[model samples]
Target: MFDKILIANRGEIACRVIRTCRRLGIRTVAVYSEADADAQHVRQADEAYCIGGPRPQESYLRGEAIIEVARQTGARAIHPGYGFLSENADFADAVEAAGLVFIGPKAASMRKMGSKAGAKELMQAAGVPVVPGYNGTDQSPETLAREAARIGFPLMIKAAHGGGGKGMRVVRVLDEFMASLESCQREAAGAFGRDRVLLERYIGQPRHIEFQVFGDVHGNVIHLNERECSAQRRYQKVIEESPSPFLTPELRAAMGEAAVKAAQAIGYVNAGTVEFIVAPDGAFYFMEINTRLQVEHPVTELVSGLDLVEWQLRVAAGEPLPLRQEQVRQQGHAIEVRVYAEDPDAGFLPGSGRLERLRLPAPSAHVRVDSGVVEGDTVTIFYDPMIAKLIVHDADRPRALARLREALAECEIGGPKSNVEFLERLVRHPAVVGASIDTGYLDRHLDEFMPAAEVDPDLLLAAAVAQLLAQERAARERAAGSGDPHSPWALADGWRLGHAGKRELAFVHRGAPLALVAHGSGGDYRIEHAGHDVVVNGARIEGDALSLRLDGRGRRFRVDSDPHRVMIHDGERRLRLEPVEVYRRQSGGSAGGEDRIRAPMPGRVVLVRARPGDPVRAGDEVLVIEAMKMELSLKAPRDGSIAEVRAAPGDFVEADAVLVTLEA
Candidate 1:
C-alpha cells in the first residue's frame, strides 16, 4: 500500500477517507480552501495545505494546484473524495502523468462514463438496459422539444454532465418544456461548462438503487450488493440504505450481475457505482455510472464489511482483488441520513452561520457519525451545506431504522437552522417505513411534509409565565435585605398595598411579538390573561436564565434578562421569546406600490436577462444567482417596465441586494 496519500477534497468525505487511511497505517494529506482553514478535516490530516479561496472554483476544482500540493507533500497517491474533481478525467490524467497514482477508475474509463449522453450510448452498445430517450448529439431547441414530445410529457431534461441534481428538470407538459429547457441549459452551462442536454422518459414509481462495484489492476471486479436511495428532495438524495428493503434475493442477484457487467464494459477499475432506476414492475434501467466513491458509500461499507478507501489504496498500489464475487456477502442492513444545514420551512434554502453547539448522539456498536464540522465552525454559502452523514447498522432493516430515528432525536445542533425534524418525519413516514418509496414520494406528499402552522399559543404563554415567576424568585434571593437568601418575599416588599401591580414584559415567539403581564405576589403569582395559569415551584437561577418546574411538564425556561428573550424547552419543541417593544408611528394615508427585485441570498450574479427600458411580465427570468452549488433564478415580481438594473454578470451580491427595479 502507498505510504502517504493526499485527499483532494474537503468536508465529510475527506474526513471519512482519512479515517480509513489511518486504520491502514497510511498517512493522509488534506487540501482546503480559505473557508475550511480550521475545518475538522484539516485537523484530522497528517499534513494540510490551503489551495485557494472559499469558492470551489477557486479551490477544490483547481486540479493542477492540488496535484502540486500532492507532489510537494510527497504523496504517493491522490484520493478524490466524491465531489469537486472526483469525476474529472483530466484531473485523473494529471495525477497519473505526474507519476502519482489516482485512487479511482482509470482516466479512459472516466472519460467514457463522465458524460450522460456518452455513457448511455456506451451502455446501450454493451447491451445494458438503458432508459428510452433521446441520447443523440443534437442541441437545437426545436429538436429537443420534438424528442420530448415523442418521449411523452413528464420527461426529464437532464444535463449530460450533471450530478447532485443540478442542471436537471422534470417537464410534465409541453407548455413548461421550452422554458424549463432554457433554464436547464443555463444552469448546466454555469455548473458543468456544458450546455448539452438529453431527454429521458420519467419513471413514475421509480426507486433509485445502485450497486457498489470494486475492481483491481488485475481486471477482477465484484459487486458489493446495492443501496436504495429513493428518499430524495429536489431530485437530490436525502436518505440511503443497504441492502435495499424492496430488493428480493432474485432481484439482487440480477442487479449485481448487471452492475458488474456495466463496470466491465467501461474497463472500470477501483471503486465506482452503477446507478439504476428500478421501476415497480421489477425492471431496472441504467441511469448512469458514478466513476468514484459515492457520497453515501458508508451504507454499503457497513453492510459489506469492507473499507472501500483501503481497497482504493491497495488497488492503486498494483494489487489484485483480494476477494472474488462469490466470496463477498451482505452482513446486515444499514441506513444513512444526510444531515444538512438548511431550513426546511424556507424552501430548504441553505443557512450559513457559526455553529454555536454541535452535540452528537452517544455512539454505540451500531451507530457511526461521519462529520467534517464541529462547534464554533462557520457554515458558509460557498459549498454544499451537508453537515454530516449519520449511519446506523443492525441485523434487520427495521432495527436499523429504529436506531437511525433514535440517533437523530438524540443529536442536537444549536446554531443555524437544520432539517433534523424534517429528517425524523421522513424516516417515520408510513411509505418509507413500509418500504413503499419512489422518486415522486416527496413531491406527492409535500403538503403533509411541510406544514405552515403557528405554534400553540397556550404553550408559549405557559412557558413565558413560568419564566417570569422564576426570574422574580431569583431576584428576591439576590437582594441584601433578605435574611433567608432564597426568600421570595425580599423582592415583593415593594408591592403596593391596595392592588396587584402588573408590569409589561415583551416576548417574541417564532418571530412574532407577544406582550406578557407579570403580577407581583408574596410567594406565588398569577399570569393575568395568560392562556394557562402556570405555577412555578423550586425556582433556581443559572447565570442570566432561570430554571423552574411547571405544571408537571418538566419544562425549563431560560430567560435572558437583558434582551428579555426567554427560551422555553418543552422536550421536543423550543419556544423562543423576544420582548416586543411598542413604538409610536405617524398616521399616514395609503402608500403607493413600487416594483422591486431583490436577491434571495448572497451569491454571484451569473446572468442578466433584462436591462433598463425592457418590458417584462411577472414570473419572467430576470437574473440568475449562483449560491451553494445551485442556481436560483430571480424572476420579475410583477408586470412592469425595467427601470434599473444594478447587478451584472460576475458581480458579487449580498442577501436582499437590489438586482433590478421596475416601474409600475
Candidate 2:
C-alpha cells in the first residue's frame, strides 16, 4: 500500500476513505474548499490543503490544483471520493499523468461509462440487456422529437451524462415533450457540462437495484450481491439496502452475472456499481454504470463483510483480487438511510446553518454512522446538505428495518431543519416494511408520510415542560450568585403567595400561533389548548432531558433550547416551539398574500418564465431557483396575471423573499 494518499473530495465520503486509510497505516491528505476549512474531513486528515472557494466550480472540480496538492504533499495515490471528480475521466487521466495513482478505474473505462448514451451503446454491444430507448447520436431537436414520438408518450428524457437523478425528466404526454426536453437539457448542461440527452421508455413500476462490482489489475472481477434503492424522493435514492427483498435467488444470480459482465466489458478496476432498472414483470434493463465508489457503498460493505475502500487501495497498489467470485458472501441484511439537512414540509428544500447540537446514535456492532459534520459545524450552502448516512445491519430485512427506526430515534440534530422524522416515518411505512414498493412508491404515497402540520399534544406537553425547566434552571443559577437564595425575584414560575388562577403562555408551532392556558399551581397543572385539555401531574428537567407525567402517563423527552426557541425530540419526531413574546405588539395586515410568490428558500434565480402582465394558471412554472446544486421551480398559485417580476435571472435572494406578484 502507498504510504500516503490524498482524498480529492469532501464531506462524509472523504472522512469515510480516511478511516480505511488509517486502518492500513496509510496516511491520508484531505483537500477542502474555503467553506470546508474547519470541516470534519479536514480535521481527520493527516495533512490538509485548501483548493479554492466554496463553490464546486472554483474548488473541488479543479483537477490541476488538486494534482498540485497531491504532488506537494507527496501523496502516492489520489482517491476521488464519490462526488465531485470521482467520475471525471479527464481528472483521472490528469492524476496519472502527474505520476500519482488514481485509486479507481482506468481513465479509458470511465470515459466509456461516463456518458449515459455511450454506456448504453457499449452495453448493447457487449450483449448486456439495455433499456429500449433512443441512444443514437443525433443532436437535432427534430430528431429527438421524432425519437420521442417513436418511443411513445410517458417517456423519460435523461441527461446522457447524469447520475444522482440530476438532469432527468419524465414526460407523461406528447404535448409536454418539447418543454420538458428543454428543461431537462438545461439542467443537464448546467450539472454535467453536457447538453446531449437520451430518451427511454418510462417504467411504470420500476425498482432500482445495483450490484457492487470490483476488479483488480490481474483482470479478476467479482460481484458483491445487490442493493435495492427503490425508496426515492425526486428521483434520488433515499434509502438503500442489500439483499433486496424484491429479488429471488434465481433473479439475483442472473443480475449478478450481468453486473460482472458489464464491468468486465468496460475493463473496470477498483470499485464500481452496475445499476439496473427492474420492471414489475421481473424483466431488467441496464440503467448505467456508476464508475466509482457509490454514495451508498456502506450497505454493500455491511452485507459483504468487506472494506471496499481497503480493497480499492490494495487493488490500486498492484495487488491481486482479495477474493474470488465464489468466496464472496452476503451474510446479513443491511439498510442505509441518508439523513439530510432539508425540510420535508418545505418541499424538502436544502437547509444551511450551524448545527448547534448534533448527537448521532452511539455506534455499536449493528449500527454505523458515516457523517462529515459534527456539533458546532456549519452546513453551508456550497454543497450537498447531507447530514449523515445511518446504516443498520441485521439478519433479515424486517429486523434491519426495525433497527433503522430505532437508530433514527437515537439521532439528535438541532439547528437546521432535518428529514430525520420523515425518514423514521418512511422506514415504518407499511409498504417499505412489507417490502412491496417500487421506484415510484415514495412519490405515490408522499401524502401519507407528510401529514398536515398540526399541534401534537405530546409535543406541546414536552415543550411546555422544557420551557418551565429551562426557566427554573436559569433562576437557580442566578440565585446561586446572588446574596439571597430565597429571593422572590430569582424564582422562575409565578406561583407565589396564592396569586395563580389561570396563567396563559403563547407559542408558535409549525408557524401557527398557539395559546396555552394552565390552571392551578403548587406543581399540579391543567393545560388547555385547541379544545383539548391535559392534566400534567408534574414535570422535571435534568439537563436537556425532560420527564413529564401527562394524564398519569410518564414519558421522557430530549429537549434543546435557545433563548426563544425550544426543540422537543420525542421518539422519532422533532418539534420546534417558539415562545410568543407577551410584550410584542401584534400588527399585521396579513403576513403573506395569495398574489405574491416568494422564493421558498434562499437560492439564485436560474430562469424566469413569467414576465410582468403575463397570464398564468395555478401550477404554471413562473421561475426556477437553484440552491445547493438542486433546482426548484416556483409556480403560480392561481389563475392570474403577473403584476410584477421581483427577481431576475442570476439574482440571489433570501428565503421567503417575494420573487413575483400576481393579480387576479
Candidate 3:
C-alpha cells in the first residue's frame, strides 16, 4: 500500500475514504475549497490544503491545483471520490502523467464508458443486452426528431455524458419532442460540457438495478450482487437497497454476468458500477456504467461484508483479486436513504443555511450514518445539499425497511428544511413496504405522502406549548443573570399574580395565522385556538423530543425547533410552524399576491424570460433560478404586464426576493 494518498473531493465521500486509508495505515491528505475550510473531511484527514474558492470550478474541479497538493503532501495516489473530476478522462490521465496513481480506472477505460452513447455501443459489441435507442453521432435536429418518431412516443432524451439525473428529459408527446430536446441539450452542455444526446424507449414501471463491479490489473473481475434504486423522485434515487425484492436467484445471476461482461469489455480497473433497467418480466438491458464509486456503495458494503474503498486501494497498489466470483457472498439485506436539505412539498427545492441544530441517530450495529457536516456548518449553494446517507442493515428486507423508517424518524435537522420526514413516509407507504416500486413511483404517488392542507390541533398545540415553555425558560435565565431571581414577575410564566386571564400567542402554521391562548402556569396549561380548547396537563421538551398531555391524553413527538420555526414529527407526518411576526416580516403580504413574483429559494437567476412591460399569463415561465445545482422556474401568477423586472439573469437573489413586479 502507498504511504499517503490525496482525496480529490470533499464531503462525506472524502471523509469515508480517509477512514479506510487510516485503517490500512495509509496516510490521507484532503483538499478543500474556501467554503470547506473547516469541513469535517479536512479535520479528519492527516494533512489538509485549501485549493481555491467556494465554487467547484474555482477549486474542486481544478485538476492541476489538486495534483500540486498531492505532490506537496507527498501523496502517492489520489482518490477522486465520485463527483467533479471523478469521471473526467483528462483528469485521470493527468494524475498518471504526474506520476501519481489515479486510484480508479485508467483514462482509456473512463473514456470508453464516460459517454452513455459510446458505452451502449461497446456493450452491444460485447454481446451485452442494451436498451434499444439511437446512439449514433448524428448532430442534426431533424435526424434526432426522426429517430424519436421511429422509437415511438414516451421516449427519454438523455445527455450522452450526463449522470446524477442531470441533462435528462422525458418526451411523452410528439409536440414536446423539440422542446424537450432543446432543454436536455442546454442542460447537458451546461452540466457535462457535452451537448450530444441519445434517445431511448421509456420503460414504464421499470426497476433500476445496478451491480457493483470490481476489476484488478490481473484481468480478474467479479460482481458484488445488485442494488435496487427504483425508489426515486425527479429522476434521482431517494432510497437504494441490496438484494432486490423483485429479483430471483436466476435473474440475479444473469444480470451479474452481464455486468461483469461490461466491466471487462472496457478494461475497467478498481471500483465501478454497471447499471441496468429491469423489466417486469425479468428482462434487463444495459443502462450505463458509473466509472467510479457510487453514492449508494454503503448498502453494497453492508450486504457483501467488504470495504470497497479497501479494494480500490489494493487494486491501485497492483494487488490481485481479493476474492473470486464464487467466493463472494451477500449475507443480509441493507438499505440506504439519502437525506437532503430540500423541501419536498415545494417542488423539492434545495435549502441552504446554517444548521443551527443538527442531530442524527447514533450509529449502532444495524444503523450507520455517513455525514460530512456537523452543527453550525453552513450548507451553502456551492455544492450538493445532501446532509447524510442513512444506512440500515438487517436479516431481511422487512426488518431493514423498518429500521430505516425508525432511523429517519429519530433524525433532527434544524434551520434548513430537509426530506427526513418525506423519507420516513415513503418507507412506511404500503406499496413501498410491500416492495411494489418503480423509478417513477415516488413522482406518481407524491400526493399520498403529502398530507391534506387541513391543520392538526394536537400538532399546533404542541408547537405553541413548546415555544411558550422555551421562552419562559429563557426569561427566567435572563432574570437570574440580572440578579433578580427572587422577583415574582420573572419567576412565573402566564401567572403574573395580577394580570392573568388568558395570554395569547400568535404563530403561523403552514402560512395560516394562528392565535393560541394559554391559561395556566408552570407545566400545566390550557391551549385554545380556533374555538378549540386543548387542555394541556403537562408539557416539556427534552432535546428533540417533546412530551405533552392534552385533555388526559399523553403524546410524545419528535420536535426540532429554533426561535423562529418549530418542526413537529408525529409518526409519518411532519408539521412546521413559525412565529407569526417572523412569518409576516419574511412574507410581507405580497408573497401570494398577484402583484409580484418572488423567488421560492435563494439562488442565482440563470434565465430571465420576461422584460419590463411584457405581458404574461398565469403559469407562464418568468425566470429560472439555479440553486444547489438544481434549477427552478418562477412563473407568472396571473395575466398582467410586467411593471418591472427586479432581477436579471446571473444575479444572485435571496428567498422571497422580488424577481418581477406586475402592474396593479
Candidate 4:
C-alpha cells in the first residue's frame, strides 16, 4: 500500500515485518543499536540506520530518533512490532504528529489500554466480564493495603503499564502483602517508568486464553478464535496453541464476543489481542489487552489461514475489513514453543553468548521458525535472549504434538544453555499430553520435567564413542598432511605387532567418572566400560548424527561436541559429558571459596544489600541484578563480612565481572 515503511523494533518481529513488506513490494527500513549493527534484520532490510547505543533506552526506545530515520528513508509508515514502543501512546502520537502513519491502533486507543487499571475499568463498563479487584486511582500505600485486606489473601499485584511477565507478584498471605507490593512496585518503576499498580483476585490453576481481535477505521471488528497459553513458567507462556482444547463451542463463542466488545469499546484499530484468565468452572474474566501483534501470532495465522501482518498493513492503508465475522474460520491445530537462551535447571537463569553451533529443523509448509539470529549471532544481554519461535501445525492436535517432538529432536544448540530439552520433556509430561496443564503446574511440578541428575549409561557410552571416533579421525587427518600416513603413532588405532593395544579414554558425566577402552578403529571398534565389554561397529558422525552398533544392536544419537564439551541427544533427552580435564577445570575447587561474587549474567546492578564491613550469612541476599526481563538476587556464599562493593545501583556490568568482594 505504501512505498516504504520503517520497523521500530528489532529481533524476530522486525524480521517478520520485513518479509511481509517485501512480499507486498514495499521497501522496509530497519533501525538498530550499536550491539545489533550486524543483526539479521539490518542485512535483510532495504535500508538500515544505526540509532544509538546497545541499551534499549539509548536506541530502540528513542521514538524521536526512529521517526527521524523514517523521514530520512522516506518511509510513509512505521511498524512498532509488539514490544518496546509498541504500546507507548505518546510515541504513537508523536509519529502521527510527524505526519507518518503509526501502522497500529490509534493513539487514543493505545492510551486507553496502556494502563492495566484503566483497561480493566473500561472493560467492565463495556459489559465485558472483569475480575473482581481494585483498579481505583488511590496511589497511597495505605489505600493499597486497605484494598488488599478487603480483597483477601492470594491476590495479584500487577504493574499498571507493564507486560511480558515483568513487574508482577503474587501475595499469598497477609504478612507477605507489603513486601510483595514493594517488590512489585520497585520492578514496575524500573521497567515501565511507573510505580502504579493494580490488584486482582488471584485465580488458582487458571487457563490463559487470548483472542486475536482486529479492527479497521470502518468500525468493523472481528475475532480470530483464541490461543490456549496455559502452559507457562513464572507467568510466561512456554507453549501456545490455537482453538483451546479446554474451550467448548459455547464458551468459545461467548469469550470471542466479549473480546470484540472490549476492542470496540476502545476503538482499537489494526491488530490486538484480548487476553482472559479462565477458571476451572468456565468462568472467564478479562486479564488485559495487548495493543499490537503478539509474539505468538504465527499459531493463529497457521490455523486461521491468514497473514496478520498483511492485515495490519492494509488496515493502516485505510482498507476495510478483509472478511466479516461470519467468514472467520479456523482450519486445523497449530502450536508454538518459544526457545530461549536460558537454563531451566539453574533457576531459569538467562544466558548470553555466541551461538557456537546452532541448528534448527528446516522450515516447511507444516513447520516455521521465526528468528532474528543465525548460527554465528551473539545473543547479547542488551535485549531479550530469545533465540527463535518454533511453530508446528497439523491436521489435528495429536498430529501436531507428534510433529513438534520430531522437530524438537532435530534441534541442536551449542554454547549458551537453552530450554530446548526442558521443553521436549514438558511436551511429553502426562499433564501436558493430556492437555490438563495450568499456569502454576510447571512451577509446582518442575522436578517431573527435569532430567535425572545422573546421566544414562547408554547416553554416556554414545558420548565416549563419538568423542573417541572424532579424535581418531582428527589424528588421521593430521597424519595425512606433512607426516607419514602409514605411521601407527598417527593412526593411534591401538596398533601393535602382536595384538592391538587398547586405547583408554576417560570422561565425566554429571560428576560421575566414566572409563572406556576401545579396540579396533575405522568405524568398527570393541569398547569396554565399567568392567563390561561390548563390540561397537559402524560408529561414525554424519553432520550432527552419530550412528553406531553396540553388541549387535543399532543406536543413533545427535552429537554436538568440541574439545571442551560433548552433548549427546538420545532421541528423548540430552546428556552433557566432558573430558576428564575439562570437567575438572569446570568443577573448579575455588568456585565456592572465592571471595568475590561475579555477575551471573550481564545486567545492571539494581541493589546492593550489603556494604563493606556488613556481616551476612550464607543465604543472605548480597546484591540483586536484573537481566533478560527478570531479577536475580546474588546471595552470600558463606557467613562473612563484606569487604568491598565494586558496583552500585545502575552500574551495568559484564558477565563474570566481580561486582562485590568479601573478606578473604
Worst 10 residues of 1 by lDDT: 582-591
Model 4 gets an lDDT of: 0.89
Ranking by TM-score: 4, 3, 2, 1
Question: TM-score: which candidate is best?
Answer: 4
Ranking by lDDT: 4, 3, 2, 1
Residue 230 of model 4 has an lDDT of 97
Q: Which residue pairs of candidate 4 clash?
A: none
Candidate 1 vs candidate 4: the TM-score winner is 4
Give all TM-scores, in the order shown.
0.83, 0.88, 0.90, 0.92
Give me the displacement of residue 531 in model 2, in angstroms. 4.2
- lDDT of each residue in 328-424, candidate 3, tens digit only: 9998899999889988778788899888778898999899999999999989887999999999999999999878887887787877889887787
RMSD of each: 5.1, 3.9, 3.2, 2.8
Whole-model Cα lDDT per candidate?
0.81, 0.87, 0.89, 0.89
- Give the winner by TM-score: 1 or 3: 3
Give me the runs in candidate 4 sitting further than 4 Å from their true place.
138-197, 496-499, 508-513, 540-544, 562-564, 581-594, 606-612, 648-652
lDDT of 4 by residue, 1-664 (tens): 8999999999899999999998999999999999999999999999999999988999999999999999988999999998899988999999999999999999899888878898898999999999888988897889999999999878999998887789989899989988999999999998889999999999988999999999999999999999999998877889999879999999999999999999999998999999999999999999888889999999999999999999999999999989999999998899999888988878888999898778899999899999999998999887889999999999999999988998888787877889888889988898988999998998899899886786677787788788888888889789899457887678767777787767888887656787888888777887787788888888989998899988888999998888888888887888877789987885565343558788888898889888899998888899999887667899988888999999999998887788878898
| lDDT tens digits, residue span 312-338, model 1 | 888889999878889888998999998
Encode model 2's per-residue lDDT on 467-506: one tens digit a residue: 6656667878999999999887777666557567566777
